[model samples]
Target: MKLLFLLKEGFAGFRRARLAVTIALATITLSLALLGLFGLVAQNLSDSFQRVFYQIRLEVFVDPSLSESDFQTLKSEIERIEAVQSAEYISPGAALQEFEKDFGKDLVAVLESNPLPPSFRVLLKTGHSRPEAIQAVVRRIEALKAVDEVVYPENLIRLLDKYFLLGILIAVGLGTAIFAISTLLIFNTIRLAIHSRQRVIEIMRLVGATDAFIKAPFIFEGILQGLIGGLLAAGLLWLAGDLVRYLFLPGLSVPWLYLAGLVAVGVLLGCIGSYLSVGKYLNA
Candidate 1:
């Protein structure tokens, strides 16, 4: 009987503060939609970066003086490294041929001899692809007597690492700001709703109503508000994403996880906002 009354009051709170609830729901919808859009952008950019990372390979230039048998042995030794996925030997002739294809000119005609060293084009395991991991691999290769040089885009890797971290920090800062704003908006609205029932709440408290009992209805109302706002926000974000994607990029993929998460965020925020408001009355 008490549970039923709390449930009834929970749903009734929305009716009691219909205007405030409507405004709060709209605010939550806009906030969550923006957050969802940001999440989608972040996810796609991360995917694109991983694709580029997969293309990065370590080029190990070997000492040209080594015998063909010794070179083959060296290649085999490199292949044994744990980080090395595969090491393909690029013979001097093969390198020259590849160069000529790119330049469309015979290098032999321009130079007295083929100066390109025999090298190994090594693909690394995915685990060893980070800027720090690749550095260890470079040190390992450089330690070898057969290797003259280990050529890779060290600067590019460092730049990417720096910028990637910066991007995450910026995103987190922005997301937090948006979250705080949304939280406060809902909190204020819930506070106002509860304020309207101060007399009833005081009477309930005097009649031996536990704090939990008094708080339940407000919590339920806030959660309901959040749920509706979340659904609206998720739908708005999806529609905006779909429309903009079709116009700007023909193949913009929708991440369902992000969309679902946005709705969850909305519900969570609503619950939190309600609790925050009720705490004021209970001094909790």
Candidate 2:
């Protein structure tokens, strides 16, 4: 009965201070939405890159003029390496055929012969995705007498490493800033709400109400406010996902679990902020 009465009073207080509550909720929702969007995008980019890199094999171009014995020896040596998943010899004719498949024309018609060189296409295990590892492999392959040239996007690997580092730094900085801002906003809102009912709190204390009884309503108010704000933010995030799917990232899908986690975090922040702010006043 006492709890119900306290809840009713809390509802009345929330009604009386609807404008401030609405503003605070709106701020929280927007901040959470931005944070969620950035996190999802970063995660999706990482997953996409990993998937592409894992399936990609290093193209090791073998020397065209090497003797048959040297070619056999080179293939045998390359296959012995643990990092080398599978190394296969692609003949000049095969390379030309592949080119024709892509270009839809016989380059031989213009050049009189397949000017393309026979090569060893090497596939590496997932562990060898790093530029250093790829460089080491390229050096070993180039050292072989049969290998004329080796080429893989060495610069691209370095660029990816730099980009990944930058992305992590930016994400951490933005998340911290948004979290601090949201915490401050919620704290101030709770403080203002308490300030408005200072007289009522005093009356309750005078009437022999315990600190728990006095603080319960404020705690509930915070939880209710947070739940509403979180739901709104989640709804907006879903809408944004739909818009992105329609306009930009139709093929690159961000996981639903990530969006769900964002809403859960939003709710927790709201409840915790309200509890901390009200607890301070209750102690006072």
Candidate 3:
């Protein structure tokens, strides 16, 4: 019975201050929408970087004059390294074929002799894609007897490292700003609702109502507004998902789990803001 009365009063507060509630709802919706968009972009960029990282591999060219047994021994030794995932041997003929496939030119036909060095296309383990890890792996492989040269994309690794760090800092800074602004707006909205009903609060207090009862309805009102705003924001993101993918990231897709988390955050923010606002008024 008490819960029902509190819910009724909460809905009634919305009717009492329709314009203020609308502005608060709109602010929450916009804030959440911006946050969701930024999250999607950051996710896509991180994925792209991971894809590039996995593509990086070391090309270990070995001495071509070794016997078949020695070559196999060298390949096995390279594969035994801690960071090496697998070492695939490329023979002179296979190397010539790959050169032709990549450059659309028959190197063997042009030179009339296959001079391409036999190399091991060395793939690293999952957690060993960074520049430092790759360099450490290279140093170990180069120390082997038959390895002529160990080469990987040095500049590309450094570039990815630099950009990925920059992206993280930017995402954290913007996300914090958006959350702070949304909290302030919701707090002010609840505060205004309390101010508008100041006389009723005093009358209820004089008639023996506790502070808890007086604050319950305003908290409920804030939560309802937040719920509506979250729903609207999630719907907007769903509708814009395809367009965002086309314009920004071809592989971008907003998962249902992410949208659910966004809604949860909105509800939590509303609860905290309203609780703090009402607490301030009651204490004052």
Candidate 4:
């Protein structure tokens, strides 16, 4: 029952069943690594969606022939809309300049004259990026005099929004399922490992061994397995993140803090698995 004796027993058990312990740890590492990658991607995608949502604009191009007073009136009307964030007017020349910047100077030179129209780029408030909401605002703008076109890339935005939502749901569901299965696998592995030494456990139980005395070594062994698994999973995830970033997104490597957080989560899962499995057998 002493701490030193318990530690020695745990170490002896680990030494006696190194193969099974190693296998369980390796399986936990692989499974946790997959889960961590899924978590990282879901978090990043949600963040990207938020940033894009804030940046989306509902453009209202105006008739270039409108007088200064008419333009001012139109701008005022747009500003009064509930979902309007801010509005900026782009003159025909400015529109042409923006196009030139995108296409190149030679392309701009080929144009006989600037064909781009003056427009008002309207940034929307949060939650106003939905198609129906944008359409309502667009309709209101179109009804005003001297407005030529109202553009918001409605179809593209809707598709992106839908896909983002779908991706997030799928990722979350898959991650959860994988984690559950991994926990069971690791738990059973430890249970079987302990079961292989039933003679030792039964002997201890018969010779005035308290339940805690018998369970201590197994619990310690579980903790050791969990720590090793968490570390391996964390390392693999970090490496995979680098490979993915290099292959696809040049500046997109996993953040160190996020990786560390994932490892911590893995450790928790491992402990929970081990505790449950060992506890059940101990009770039995």
Candidate 5:
């Protein structure tokens, strides 16, 4: 069986059964699209978790009445803690200015004096953002002499570190289920194509057609359907990504390699599904 003949026969299969081919392609596109969506969300969730894990910082406010030397000593002690990565002193004036910049209002104009205490902007090492970890660190910091308060995003980190981890597990389970369902759908769709052309397949087999010769066209048919489905799914995903970027997260981006991988997976699922269905006839 020449490549050209296989190509011709594979395409002819479509002309013989347009509706079946269309159904197979539609299933492939939908399955691959859903798989791609699940993958995209999982990646974003992981990225957000990592950003919070390494970027979190705690604000350690000291008594504003402390001498400049005492403030320096406080920072030195904080930097020496087991979990502390670094601590930088933020003067009362600097803290006030930063608050003004964030709030877009001048406290000096509203109140006669800056109320912000001089503090240390403290960064923690990795694996220290969990609620328990942060609590221990806070207790230690507050115990230090002259420290007023240890401020951080306690609620936000708790939700992200604890709850988001649970969410990732659920996402993984859901993704696995979706992949199974999609594979089953493709298998069923390819089986239908085989059943519809059972007579033609039997006739070719009787005429001394080698199983490979008979299967070539069907294999190519599956690949063709998968390729078409992949293209359609990719197009839809790209459009959706664009809409999401414009509507909510202006910085959101889908990696190009991941998009390419989705297409490759589509083609792979097509070939696998086709092979499984076509194998049944070879045994018969």
Candidate 6:
């Protein structure tokens, strides 16, 4: 059958251009592996950013003269704000304890009095964790009569926001470069295969073979190369997962779906490369 012949020719093409095929396969594998590694790093950094965002709390210090009843009213008012997730009251005694735990020094023993102010550790909703949102929330809380002051790590949040944007730009630039390089290598590999088989192609043309029939074998060869390279890349990532986790990110994981998608990308790249190369040659 013609199908069997095409398949046979496709596999044979590999032998006809061994070095080119090897270079193409290696290029695809390396490119995809680099992409996978970058993906892992991005995922870990995202997780770390989320954890830091959640830990960003607004320390709402209250007047020491506030009565327990007034404190409860103030707490209710603070919690009623749309952006506020929860407000936990920290009494002077508890604040002193935390200070000692953090700095290893008892303020009461040094000063003979607890100068720590009672405060509400306000956690914002995830949606309102941005610097501008936090600032707006601070403004609203600062208006309350019972609140003496509102403080947060404004500089830290601004720096993180800036860094996150820079990271996105770098990722886009690197990903584009890798994709272009992989496509070029695969295209060159298929072109070399076609050139080496020029005599066979001419003979087939004389024998009344259609362009489709001649192109089918080359396309199949490309798909096969991509398939093999994808599998090798996936296997390499799997084998190195433990080392990656230990050395780079402790909780990093590559999902099966992501690996499957990587394989799909490889196949698509190969098909595209072969199609372009063979079409150009036949047309010329």
lDDT values of the candidates? 0.81, 0.76, 0.82, 0.77, 0.86, 0.82
Clashing pairs in 5: none
Against the correct fold, how does model 4 do in TM-score?
Answer: 0.78
- Among these predictions, the greatest TM-score belongs to 5
Rank by TM-score, descending? 5, 4, 3, 6, 2, 1
Q: What is the TM-score of each candidate against the true structure?
A: 0.67, 0.73, 0.75, 0.78, 0.82, 0.74
Supply the TM-score for candidate 5. 0.82
Per-residue lDDT over 123-217 for candidate 3, one digit per residue giving the tens place of the 0 to 100 score? 88888877887888999999999899988878988887777678678878987886677677667776776677777777877899898998898
Better of 1 and 3 by lDDT: 3
TM-score of 6: 0.74
List per-candidate RMSD values in Å: 6.4, 4.6, 4.5, 3.7, 3.1, 4.6
The true-versus-predicted C-alpha distance at residue 121 of model 2, in Å, is 6.7
Give a tens-digit lDDT track for model 5, residues 138-256: 99999999998888988888778767668878988999999999889888898898778888888988999898988888989998888888889888888999999899988677888
Candidate 1: Cα lDDT at 25:
76
User: What are the per-residue Cα lDDT tens digits for candidate 6 across 1-284?
Assistant: 99999999999888877877777788778877776666656666777788777556899999999999998999999999998989999999999999899999978788999999999999888877778888899999999997889999888888887786787788778767766776676567657766777777788778999999988998898888778877788778877887888897678787788777778877887787787777776777
Instruction: Please report, as a residue range, the 10-residue window in candidate 3 with the lowest summed lDDT.
Output: 185-194
Q: Pick out the ten consecutive residues of candidate 6 with the lowest summed lDDT.
A: 181-190
Q: Candidate 4: lDDT of 242?
A: 83
Q: Best lDDT goes to which candidate? A: 5
Worst 10 residues of 4 by lDDT: 269-278
